[model samples]
Target: MRKWREIFGASQTDVAKIMGISPSVVSDYEKGRRTPGVKFIKRFVEALIKVDNERGWVVCKELIKSLNLNPEVIIDIRELDKPMNLDTFVTLVKGCLLTSTHSQKIIYGYTVLDSIATIQSLSGNEFWQIMGLTTERALIFTKVTTGRSPMIAVRVAPVKPAAVVLHGPKKVDPLAIILAEKEKIPLILSLASDVNELVNSLRTYARVKIIV
Candidate 1:
């Protein structure tokens, strides 16, 4: 609930008013002092959807897709200030390019996600939200093993991002390389071990303004 609220840029009071409950009650629910029953959960979800729709982000559908995602996992999504080129980003991360580069694509933002959660939770359209508001953004997957799952998710998504970055020392899977070539998406493998630090570096370089 807190994640959805933050993602929608809604305040506790806002949610309380929408749900017809006291702000303290909403605070308690968020703090785990009170557990909402099924009826309240439904209302809570509706309130978030309504708030997002009114905000014109149309994030209600995206939030619904996120319901199955683990509440504990953090997905770093940000909107950057200016467009960045794929080659420049790869150089920043000191990553190896595993696939052929197409155009000097200008990326608007980047998404740092867990490969496993991406496979289990995100659908095709949901990937678009994580990739920012444009198809020219980079979808970066951390805590990856073979780097195949995230690429496969990209291949299946309704839209393909300009590039994909995989963090960790694992060798890039052959099939993943093939898929990136086929889709014409640049595939990068970063040897950086600290996923948090890597994400922070990318955020700093991209001058990301919005974090969700």
Candidate 2:
């Protein structure tokens, strides 16, 4: 519930106003002080959909499109409890930065994808699901060859990720680097031995809380 509220960029006051409830009630439900029943859950989802619809249904449309994606395309997806610095994330993933931008950015989540499965299966609109709850997250593509196709898919998408990491690519295509530079998204090359190592590293990173 809290995640969806943040994803929609809504305040507790805003949701409460629409739900005909007090902000404290909303907070109570979110914080687990008040356990929500099935009716409340239905109302909460409907309220979020209502808010999104009023705001032009941008998020709703993306979510609807995302339903078309095959499960094989996505290996893993997670939203972090706390944001982590971009530098720390790169180090955790054993990544080599390939682009100049986004040094000071923070990542809220990450999604691991099978590059071949993604490109061959999903359409332009369906790619938005990779963003997860927020675009302020890493989009790591595994089994990359030249890294061109992944970057190309990101290039045409409306929402961009905090960073892009291409795993299992010995050398990235120059065009991919150019696209990352043009988009100003920090591109990275993962130095993990294989998919297992990369996924394991990210999973470890996800569980640890950064002090800074």
Query: How far in Å is the alpha carbon of 74 misplaced in model 2?
Result: 0.7
> Total clashing residue pairs per candidate?
0, 0
Clashing residue pairs, backbone N/CA/C < 3 A, model 2: none
Residue 86's C-alpha lDDT in candidate 2? 83
Residue-level lDDT of model 1, residues 1-212, one tens digit each, is 78777877889999899888899998898889999897688568667756765766456446534554342234665555566777777876668888876557777777677776766766665555554433667777887888777777778767778788888746778999999999988899986668877877777765433333
Assess the local accuracy of residue 36 in candidate 2 as a C-alpha lDDT between 0 and 100: 96
**Which portions of model 2 miss their true places by more than 4 Å?**
1-66, 131-134, 207-212
Query: How good is model 1 by TM-score?
Result: 0.62
Candidate 1, superposed: residue stretches over 4 Å from native: 1-74, 123-134, 209-211
Candidate 2 per-residue lDDT over residues 5-95, each given as its tens digit: 9998788888888889999999999999999997698567667766776777777556644476676777776555467888888888899
| Best model per TM-score | 2
The estimated TM-scores of all candidates read: 0.62, 0.67
lDDT of each: 0.72, 0.80
TM-score of 2: 0.67
